[model samples]
Target: MGRRVHWAGIGPNPLRRRVDRAEAWFAMVLTVAVVACGPVLVWRSGETAYDRAAAAADWQRNRFVPVHAVLLQDTGDFIPVYGEDGKAKAAVQAEWTAPDGTRRVGPVIPPAPGTAGTTVLIWTDSAGNPGERPDSDPMGAAIGVGLLIALLLVAVHAGVLLGVRWWLDRRRMAAWQQEWKDVEPRWSGRR
Candidate 1:
């Protein structure tokens, strides 16, 4: 026999049994709906993150400046004591000239471990207060990574839904078999 294609209601039902047909229809509809929504969901999520990151970067760049300072003493167990390059880092009492040309003293990070006079770059805000470095790469690659994660989550959800439906279908088929076994003997005896 030739293969038959059932487009919703156009022809003979595709599956031989009613429950199988119903399950197939449900699965098809759900797959289409989730696939259709995936792009819009990912785009909105990524755009929201990018916009928030850009605003924070703008604020940091405006409020912070880099300055050179000296280490007054050894770090003595201060946190974040190593630079990104994994070299020994130390914090100490230090002095630096601020944007307004006034000398200021505060605890600052040195380029490396030093006894008293090692120079290091530190970020400071107006009024000569120590602060963190300004942000760079406003949107960066985080948006793409975020979108990928969102799409992957959508796929996983759809797969789980289908898996549950499949399990239910197996139980239904078993119940049908037991019903047939009970009725077949009675019908054959009457004939």
Candidate 2:
């Protein structure tokens, strides 16, 4: 038969100090709090982030329209710059006719190594002003933000636990020092 192990500072133990029991109870309560609150906080934060990201995506979809623009200059070979979409991009001067039938020319980012006179698709606002590409994955954004928040929460919980432990250790040290002050002289026959 295996022997059951008893947790320190729990149950009826004459050797258990008051600080030990307090530490044990505090740890138990903190564990319970983390278990009870962590999931709810993470879920709520993730839901809120997802809703906001989705709304912004919908708004951008409605506001931006695609237009074909012609590159006027060759996109020379250069270090590839990655965009939010993780795709390499190159900047070049381009011209396009807006929906309002007005000619517009500006710097545009297209796929790297673009040739002159090549037509590339670009996003623009309703008034034909340059605009960023709309976010396509709200769920990804939610997951990323949620994970970050969860990590922060975990860090906070760990810090609190460590801080409490440190305080308890200080109390224990002070009590030991006080007790030793009385015991040391008697034990050394200096009384």
Candidate 3:
């Protein structure tokens, strides 16, 4: 019961050139295919990203334990990594009591920038070595994957349409030039 569509067809008319017909068919098919495939591609990409994030979280949970620590001094160790919030990251020396009730000292990445004596939560391995916390934010993973898929879809759609349009435009111009070659002399009264 859907409305029937009329595809562009090649003709003898200069306005309905072969290149125009080809571009029309290609564009229609590409639009339909991209629209149908967008959701599936996005879903698959999101799933892959979620799986990796969940795996990392599971690994961290199994290997690390959270502990409260107090910064001993500002060791001033800075890494070039920036958080999603665009804040600079740094490592500072801190001391915490391990599960075995032994005082352990090492580098701790505070939730925010902190000076000496600032109390913060830190994760440590069973051997009392400092480590990263388990990432448990599902929203973060979803947003990240969604943005990536959107960008990819936009890029692909633009590239396909523009490439085809450019090619057809060039062909149409050449056809116009060839027709003019035959007509220009007669029109100018030279023949």
Model 2 ranges off by over 4 Å: 1-5, 77-90, 103-106
Q: Which run of 10 residues does model 1 get worst, by summed lDDT?
A: 1-10
TM-score of each prediction: 0.67, 0.80, 0.72
Q: Higher-lDDT candidate among 1 and 3?
A: 3
Q: Tens digit of lDDT per residue, candidate 3, span 1-191?
A: 12233433433456575567777778778878888998888888888888888887788898999989999875354653576768777777789998678998877778777778889888888888887777776557966997799789979998989988987788778888999999999999886
Runs off by more than 4 Å, candidate 1: 1-15, 70-88, 111-119, 135-141, 148-152, 163-178, 181-191
Q: Given candidate 1, what's the lDDT at residue 7?
A: 44
Candidate 1, residues 64-88, lDDT tens digits: the string is 8888887766566565566676875
Give the Å error, residue 67, model 2. Answer: 1.4
RMSD of each: 5.0, 3.4, 5.0
Q: Write the candidate numbers in order of decreasing TM-score.
A: 2, 3, 1
- In TM-score terms, which candidate is top? 2
- Arrange candidates, best lDDT first: 2, 3, 1
* Distance from true location, Cα of 69 in model 3, Å: 4.0
